[model samples]
Target: MAFFGFKDIDKLSEVDMAIYRYIVDHDEQVPYMRVRDLATGAHASNSSVMRFIHKIGYSSFPEFKVSFQTENQDLKNSNDDILTMFTRDAFPNDIEKTIKLVAHLMLDADNIIFIGMGASGAIAEYASRQAASLGFNCYAMKDPYYPLVQQLHNTSNNVLVTLSVSGKTIELVEMLNNFVNSADTVLTSITGNIESPIARIGRYALSYNVEETRIHKYYDLTSQVPAVYLVDGLLKELHNQDVARRIN
Candidate 1:
């Protein structure tokens, strides 16, 4: 049977194919099962199960589970209206809490560093400039001089805002890993995939569930819209809070 877009399943060894068939047939239970349990259920070895996962292009079982769950949910809700999907499903209630948290982090931080790669880099620059205009010490780090600036800056009170549509951008993930492992900095991520590596590593992760489409491969048209909305909402809330504090 065809799995996702891979159609070469028939060529797998008997044990590996058994494991694949078990996973394909028992999609709901697969997520909950450990590697050993899955191996037992498939009458295959644990190594075989792991090998199958690798052959399917996943780095780990958890990552595979995330992709599997997403794909399954998408298939079930394939007919939902696109507008509703973005406005309702993508922008959930937790977004407000996330925005509030981000605003608070920005307020408490001594310096804010916004980082992104490719299209997200533009968003980072825009957000950094906007925050700076609001009297915050912020900089958008996209230049090749980022390493030098980071080395020179005091990172203890720094808040790093990373934007990535995929959340798996190598540069962002590497930066986050370094920041989190070495410094006393706050790491925040805005991304489309919540289960992505960068999001998982972040102290505060705000994600939007944009429906993945074929158009995304050729052009990232709508992925950044929700992120922009989140930033706008956070800025407005911060402004409102400041006005209320002054009034009080």
Candidate 2:
């Protein structure tokens, strides 16, 4: 429930960032951290802390505390962990841990082959660039048919991040069936509904808990928007990993 190391919040100046971090870490304590209380704890004038809060996009300490707590209200298992951001949840503390694994696998792979189909193939390409900037070699397997085989043959030190929202792509399922499991590692980002065949094939499936399937007027899969959040979580984990490596 605490801030995810406040990466976005840290972009602000040091003083403003400190206050955001404090509110995030001690939201429950803030019902008590009044102007007088902040003055004592931060050893800065109440005016200074109040000013810092607004600079970082909060109206006042009380309002900020309320917003923080509300955002983090459901502390335990959300029925749909994929729909809810699990790292922000309290149940599986391993959400961040899993994300870190994904980022690390992407970063450390000598030759990473990402297998994805349909819209997820675009997601794979975008993720490839994100990892490349971090100094990892990534190749997004473009076509669901042949490109995957070619890409796989090119790289043995591979991490296959196969993405399927339905987890029922026939070719993807078949590929998962015939492909010799790579010795390196395999990660999946799929809506792990129990009946999903793709979920059954994946080594480690990153569950994207999409809430409901509705016939939108445009017929678009709006639920997949949460895939962006999964990518964001993965990037945060990578950033944390980079910070830890530098600190060590």
Which candidate comes out best when scored by TM-score? 1
- Which tens-of-lDDT digit does each residue in 1-248 have in candidate 2? 23333345545666655555565666577655677776556556787787876765677677866665665565533444655443344224465666766677655667766667767787878877886777667767757667465545655556667777777778877776655466645645545353588766655556655544547553435455656567667766776787787899
Clashes of each: 0, 2
Alpha-carbon TM-score of each model against the true structure: 0.60, 0.54
lDDT of 2: 0.63
Name the candidate that leads on lDDT: 1
lDDT of 2 at 235: 63
lDDT of 1 at 201: 88
Report model 1's TM-score to 2 decimal places.
0.60
Every candidate's CA RMSD = 18.2, 11.5
Candidate 1, residues 168-194: lDDT per residue as tens digits?
A: 877667666766664668888888888
